[model samples]
Target: MKNLYDLVVIGSGPGGYVSAIRASQLGLRTAIIEKYQELGGTCLNVGCIPSKSLLDSSKYFSLAKNNYSSHGIFFEKLFFDFKKMMDRKNEVVKNINNGVKYLMKKNKIDVYQGIGSFKTKNILFLKDIKSLKEKKEIQFQYCIISTGSKPSCFPHLNFHLENRILSSTEALHLKEIPKKLIIIGGGIIGLELGSIFNRLGSKIIILEPMEKIISNMDDSLSHEMQKILEKSSIQIETSLSVSNIFKENHEQISVFAKYHNGKEVKFIGDYCLLSIGRIPYTKNLELENIKIQKNKKGFIHVNDDLQTSVKNIYAIGDVIGGKMLAHKAEEEGLYVVEHIVGKKPNKLNYDLIPSIIYTYPEVASVGRSENEIKKDKIEYNIGIFPMKILARARTSGCTDGFLKMISHKKTDEILGVHIIGDHASDMIMEASIAMEFRSSSEDIYRICHPHPTLSESFKEAALLNFENRSIHM
Candidate 1:
């Protein structure tokens, strides 16, 4: 009875820990389990936080090396300390990890460091991660499974960290900058890491199996991003299916691929990074003991209320498989907690969840894409405004990318907003909020935005969508 809880959350990732905090806030006796020595999971430990830290450091170095001269600022013998950059990133992650620990203590949520496996519908056995020996048993009235995901590797290739074949995790902690890095996937992870090394003076070659990089985004975004990256001297090879990856020697690696017509090619590099995607991590949860259901892809099955097949057990985040973004998982975690408390919270609006890629120019989008709108056979009006034409872009000298807005043809209601430019990550909320309130193009256009700002592009695009004309252009 001392080990009993109203809710037990497995995994201390964004979803798991956040849910536990929320449950505690709502007066539910809660406990959270994490296998790792640290809290915050992948996003904090090796994913978003560290990647962004490196990105900012690399970007600053790049600006001094490339752009500063144009602004009449010059530095003699410019150099960057790669080790210091990595140290800062590690420190940032450590601070956040401690912050999460503090939150758990402040909320009075019991934090168990071990693997939690379901012993029965109402109980779990916590086992030592290394020895796999049972440490303790936990009883709960309800459980939330927030175990996140891991990076996926090629099915045919046997990958090892020592072989120079790396996932995002290994890529983030390299001892030295690679002279040549070959990336196997051109999604967010690949492009972001590639951008970092390319800025730091590594030759980057991105091989994407799809027709375009970031193929899941809007077509305009994919095309424009590819062009921008190419201009930065990052080589992109699309429509090439990789057949084999092997270590050529202690100092080199090779990746083999073929064209659609079967022309074979070999790419050699010091390091080969696989950034294809991620798969649900449901390992060691012992779901079978409780007979909870999962989909073919190993994602836990959740109904409309995010309840698993076993009603008392619920799952959220990457384990349930939707966007897999940290914020998405956090929202799901909050929703699940609120639902458990008998609060009639609104169902999550998946469409309004914005997607962002933190490349040099950045990319963000909300609501339906142009292709999705077309596929749905919705009559729509589109407006595009180039960044180069803006005074703010000229001032900042980052004149690459554009803002595109789509609206219903008859009603003039905004359908989607997509942007690729500086500060686009933060700028996307305007569109998301607009779409959340079902605002029309006219509404955005009428809202006064400050002069000479990146966000003005949004207003201009809205005006163009509403009346097929923009004042700036």
Candidate 2:
């Protein structure tokens, strides 16, 4: 007799592990498989968690060195230990890993430490992660593939992971911060990681092929963030494409690129950090065996219900190609499990999902950007508030960003919210909740926000939307 399950979720990431736990809660026998020995996928292991940990540490160091004197606090000699910072980050990650293990045990979900492959629509084959040998076959009623993604690299910049070259993964675990760091992409990962070393006293240079960093957000955000990065002494070169990388010496790397103005550009650095992006990682799952339909970019195809060509098999997270946020994956996991138990869950709202960049002053948004509204030729009202005007922001000594709101001109319903200020990631949730209930700008303005807090910016922007102005702004 073979082991059986009502659900088998592959990857054990935010999507996979969450779905397996939800399945168990619904009284379904569940199992989860992961290729990595430690759980939490890239988000926990090497991506979000570790990166944010370093971001936090670097932020504190930056504040003590730069802003502490403004608050009348002086130190003889302030210093940071890179090794100690990394050790603490590892501690935070290990604790979360234990928490995930506890959840799996609490739900009685069997966890297999190996890669999962499809044997049939109703059967799964597990392979040893190290040896790549088939370990077992399990019968399952349904399966979910949530194996996330890997860092994307360009052909010219590609090299073996070693001392000089690095992906975002290797960037996190570098033994020493490079003196001159040249980053090739200016997206979320690039900006966040660039800030980390820039604050650590590195001469940072960022080369972005696009016109702006975090270009997917509102143009205002892109412009404001660029100013902030430049204020921190990080060089940002936009509209430039890197053509080649050459090792000038043992520790010197030269990068060659073409500027949008048709001029050749060259840069020399101690290390080159590649933060281009990531792609779905499913090449080895033998998805071909199941004949799963993937688009041109290799993301698995799924219907509205997240079901593949075979209805019993579902796909979610980065593997399925929507917004690649961890929270997005978690929500989809919950929805799919509820769906499996004959419960009709609410549809996943990709638009309302908040996207965040965890820099010193975070960037977060939900619903739509002004660019999207303009493209559709919608009548909209806009409200913009600078963080410098807020009392809380001034007191905090970090007033380098702003919050903008967009609402329907006639109906007054809030269409989108963009924030780049203190606690923007946490603050955006209020907008998310409001948008979830279809709250109007006037509706948000009516709600009482506490005095001398960062959240007041949201309400002020809301007031500016319909009232033509705000008391503070």
Q: If scored against the real structure, what TM-score would every candidate get?
A: 0.98, 0.98
In candidate 1, what are the lDDT values of residues 369-454, reduced to their tens digit? 99999999999999999999999999998999999999999999999999999999999999999999999999999999999899
Q: Deviation in angstroms for 305 in model 2?
A: 0.8
Task: Give Cα-based local distance difference scores for all models.
Answer: 0.93, 0.91
Give the C-alpha miss distance for residue 206 in model 1, angstroms. Answer: 0.7
**Candidate 1 RMSD to the real structure:** 1.0
- Residue lDDT tens for model 2, 199-238: 9999999999999889888998999999988988999999
Clashes per prediction? 0, 0
